[model samples]
Target: MEKVTISAAAREGIGVKGALSKIRAEKKIPAVIYGGQKEPVSVTVSVKDLDKIVKAGKNTLVEMDLNGAKELALVKEIQYHAVTDNPIHADFQRVSMKDKMDVVVPLKLEGTPADVANYGAIIEHILREIEVRALVSAIPHEIVLDITPMTINKGLVAGDIKLPEGVELITDAEAPVVHLAIPKEEEAPAPAPAADAAAAQPESSSTKGKKDEEGNLTKDAAKK
Candidate 1:
């Protein structure tokens, strides 16, 4: 995992009402750094710097420059504008190199499954991310699982993913992350039954038997 230095400055207040609005107007994101067994500090970071760190992955370790003071932190949460999709606020949780933390790592699938090309089986990616426990500096940004050798109906489970040295898998071992599923044959719907088909059609007009002042079969059995 690569660590990035994030420049930050101390804020004036604990972000009371209207304080964040002012910070956002200046194109700055209001953030708070808490934990690491220290007093929480109100801070602000530029939106550009924040996006770069976030794009790298939240699991990325941040070297904070709090108006010149230093601290190591983890991005805990970020609130975004629903309409504009811009960062509104963020929270950074301080962490130490010695502390083991559990964090979610995005799952990346590598190589196409053999069944997909050979048998036209579909690959169902179930779990896109998983949790792992490791030291602050040891956390990985993503987990890559290879499916090149997978066959039809075969899958890679959570345990199949190999973690970096000194990292521990916190996700369940039996949970399936990705799998190959056989495609269902598109069978034409069954033909309608014969009797039902007949009922569906119009009935033929009834024949009027020949009659001499009477409706009855006559004259050589209706000329059989």
Candidate 2:
């Protein structure tokens, strides 16, 4: 598990439209922290700073410093602007050190399958992520699928991967992660049209202006 630290400020007058608008204009995002058996708190954090943390993935663990009071949380949700696609609001769920939680971990394919290029094959990723339960400290940064030993027409499923100790798979073992593909054989070219006797005549550049010993064109040359 990767732990991170971010700072935030307890927001004042957040419910007011005027105050929320001002925060967005300043490039800050309004967020709420709930759970951990405490009343939800409204806070504001830098849009630029929090954006970096979320890019690490939703399962990332964060320790927020809200004006000296610390809280452990998972970024539960992020609302993005429909047009600009920028982060507008965020929701955090407070968690405890002892909690065994389910989080979605990203799946990464690690190697090239054997004979992929020679066979004109492709690797199609089916399940790009999986949910797992573990203590906050036991979550893996990613789920890795090693395909070096996989050959064309082969596949891997959730059962194929061995995870870090203390992590339990919540996804189905039979669910496929990736599979190698072989492209279909192309249809044979239509038999070339039967040769056209006239069209197959010798190239003109090679036979142009030929004449006989009498200085008269030969019968084949005269036909040009």
Candidate 3:
């Protein structure tokens, strides 16, 4: 697997919120390392360093250098500030190169399905990513599937996927990843005819009866 080198430093006495704010202000991102037998370590890294590493995708194997001490880790989770849209925090799980780990890999569609071009069928991607189990060093960044033969009502399922050696799919084999279907056109209901509208109107006799009841109530109230 391709590796990205990211530099980080052990945080000092500052609290997590304060340290995270300071890190963001310096154009750096705050992160934590967990998993294995060790306590989680809070660290900070450069934002530019992360942008380059994140391009390798979420399941990528990352080599983290913490003040010169190196370790192999994988991106587990990332937290982003809702308003600022900045990466506020992240989690990295340490792993051994020889051990198999479960991770989600992005799905890449290759080749235009024939139905989409020749039969006016719309192509829909039901799954954007899939989980797989593989060695940390053998984990793939993305899985590519061909859809050239797909036509209307046809689909490609997880079982049809061909993965690289040593990479086993953790997602359901029968789950559909992509589907081709004809576009649905909605038709508006027809307007009611004028005769039907006239026939449905409330009877004038009922209105007159209602008015008579009101008049009787007013007379009774006046007598009281």
1-224 in candidate 2: lDDT tens per residue?
Answer: 67778999999985676998899898999999999899999999888768878777667889999999999998988999899998899999999879898888899989887678678688888999998999988878787778888876568889877889999999999999888877788999899879876467654674555767865668888776
Per residue, candidate 1 scores C-alpha lDDT tens digits across 88-199 of 9899999999899989989988999767888888889999999999988888888788888888756889998888899898899999998889878999999986676435
- Which model, 1 or 3, shows the larger TM-score? 1
TM-score of 3: 0.81
lDDT (0-100) at residue 115 of candidate 3? 67
| Model 1 regions more than 4 Å off | 13-17, 193-224
Which stretches of candidate 2 lie above 4 Å from their native place?
55-57, 188-224
Worst 10 residues of 3 by lDDT: 206-215
Q: Rate the local accuracy (lDDT) of all candidates.
A: 0.85, 0.85, 0.82
Lowest lDDT 10-residue stretch of candidate 2: 198-207
In terms of lDDT, which candidate is stronger, 2 or 3? 2
Tens digits of lDDT, candidate 3, 1-224: 88888899887756645765677789987788888778889888788887887787768788999988887898888888899787878888998987999888899999997667787887799999999999888888888888887777668888789999999988999999999878888899998765764357644542333334334434434444
**TM-score of model 1 vs. true structure:** 0.85
Q: Which pairs clash (backbone N, Cα, C closer than 3 Å) in model 2?
A: none
lDDT of 3 at 40: 89
